[model samples]
Target: MRSGRLSFSFTMLMIGIAFLYVPMLVLIGYSFNASPLVSVWGGFSVKWYGSLLHNRQLLDAALLSLEIALLSSTGAVILGLLAATALVRFRQFRGRLLLTGMINAPLVMPEIITGITQLLLFVSMAQMFGWPHRGLTTIVISHVVFCGAYAAVTIQSRLITVDRSLEEAARDLGSTPLRAFWDVTLPMIMPALASSWLLSFTLSLDDLVISSFVSGPSASTLPMVIYSKVKLGVTPEINALATLIIVAVGACVVFAGYTMRRAERQRDQEMQAAYRQPAG
Candidate 1:
């Protein structure tokens, strides 16, 4: 009975993996087809990739997307770190639950609503302060708002897992609160910080709807470019671009996991060594 159950579970797991990977496999396969129509494979060719590289507009849009992702993710990490610290350290405060809920509300809210709200706010700000017209800055700001929520949640969970005694020990050893945080708490949460930053970056880079609503005519993102092209019709070029993005993101994920595992191993080794040392 146990063997039968294990086989069934294994089969189900394989089915789930196939379900997730089959579409991606199809996309990658079509990317190599020479035909303009993705459905029909004329022959294998690299022309689509070459064309993608030469498309100035697409390149510009990609650059803009990168810039926005970098700025928005960085801003989100900073804001999220502060919010997470506040949430964890100031647990006695009134409305803590309400504030936490507000911070995480974006995760559940509809993207269209968030987009519309950001659009209206940008318009209002521009009209009131005669601020710079909405474009990349506005899009970045909108992304940061949502991205920060995700980062905060990630960081907060990690913070809760950390031992409070570490910080207390640091403080008891004559470290100021700030020093204790930097020396003890921050180091402990470095992995969470790294993970949160990358998560925010990926989220911002992949965002389309909110960025579309907030961005002006001049600041088109990679997703916007892809969406416009997709509206006309699918092409091998798009498939090629999608495949490239998949490969790049996959590589990044693999590298991050490898680095994190290495760090954890080193940490474990250090702990072992310390335990083996003679006590003074």
Candidate 2:
């Protein structure tokens, strides 16, 4: 019966949600454990959070990770915007296919392969030029190159849906092409730009394999630190750190969603008001 099928589907949906969220819930629960050992359920305590604050190495690693995420996301967005503009607007240029393929290369390549290739490339450059030296700068460079590909893909998808006429109208009103793009096209794709930057930040923050290959011993990231700790064994401190990250990211997502909805509502109001106006 249709009713029976509907009931089964609802049960399956609930199962799917549980499958995805149960681990996160468990991790969150363990974050409050007073005991250091993750496996043992100790009474609730915020002791680990206090300890985490004074852990200099971990704090340094976290700060470095945040810096990389901010810088690399900014760099990736600029590079990606350029790539997206060229691909979408200058479709008939020579080597278009090659350029497009290169921009998308990271999406298809395995992390190990990408990491190794970048490592080798950096080594060759450093050997020849005596520069970069596989530290923070080198890590940022690798992240920019890798993250830019994703940014380009994200922006390009949004660009395809955008109306070219907006920019053209700006140009017709005596704006230069570049000015028109700055004033019109950029605003239209603001959502995509925000998305691209956020995604790039997440990718750079989450990266382990690529960062390991590119970063020096002195420039270990938060993920690198967590990974090393995990090798020894999970602890309440790590669980606490992870839970904090989850909370921070969730807060950011909520804020972004709210901003986007507000923008949409404002735009809708403006459009409706414009429609109500008498013809000039």
Candidate 3:
């Protein structure tokens, strides 16, 4: 009975995997199709990808998206790190709960609401200050607002796992609090920072609703371009683009996993070597 149950569970897991991945597999396969209709498969051809190179508008939009992603991700990481540090280190402050709630409120709020609110604020600011009428800057600001919340949550979680004793020990050894943080806490949480940055980058790149609301005529992101094209008609070019993005993200994830594994292996080897060394 136990063996039968195990076999059943394995089969269910396989089915779940197939259900989740089959659509992506089909999309990737169709990227090579010669037919314009993505649903219908034609003989393999690289024309779509080749055309993508020549499409100046799409290329420009893609570049804009990359820029927004980079800038917003950087901003998010900086703000999030500061917020996370405050939340973790200044736990006794009054209004801590309120601050935490405000920091996390974006995560649960509807995207439409967030977009509308940002748009209103941008318009008001523009009218009042006559600054940043509309463009990449506005979009980056909107993205940073949302993405920072996610980064803060990730970094705060990592902080919770760290031992405070390490920092205390460093302080006792004549290191300033800031210097101790740099030497001890920073190294331990570096992985979380890297992860948070990547996560924010991906979120900013993939954003559509908030970006669309805040963006002006000059700044069109990749998602906005893709969305506009979808409204007109679905094209094989979109499939090709989607496939490329999926492959890029997948490669990054794999590379990160490999690097982490290598670090672990090196650490294990060092520990084993130390154990094997003569008693001191």
lDDT by residue for model 1 (159-234), tens: 9888788799889999999999999889778888888899899899989899889988778899999999989887
Displacement of residue 59 (Cα, Å) in model 1 is: 0.4
Ranking by lDDT: 2, 1, 3
TM-score for candidate 3, please give it. Answer: 0.90
lDDT of 2: 0.90
For residues 52-149, what per-residue lDDT tens digits would candidate 2 score against the true structure? 99999889999999999999999999999999999999969998998899998889899899888888998999999988888789889989988999
Q: Tens-digit lDDT track for model 3 on 114-230?
A: 998988998999999997778788888888888999999999998888879979989999999999999989877777788788989999999999888888877889999999998
Off by over 4 Å in 2: 1-10, 275-278
Clashes of 1: 0
Cα distance off (Å), candidate 1, residue 43: 2.8
- Model 1 compared with the native: what TM-score? 0.93
- Clash numbers, per candidate: 0, 0, 0
Residue range with the least summed lDDT across 10 consecutive positions in model 2: 263-272
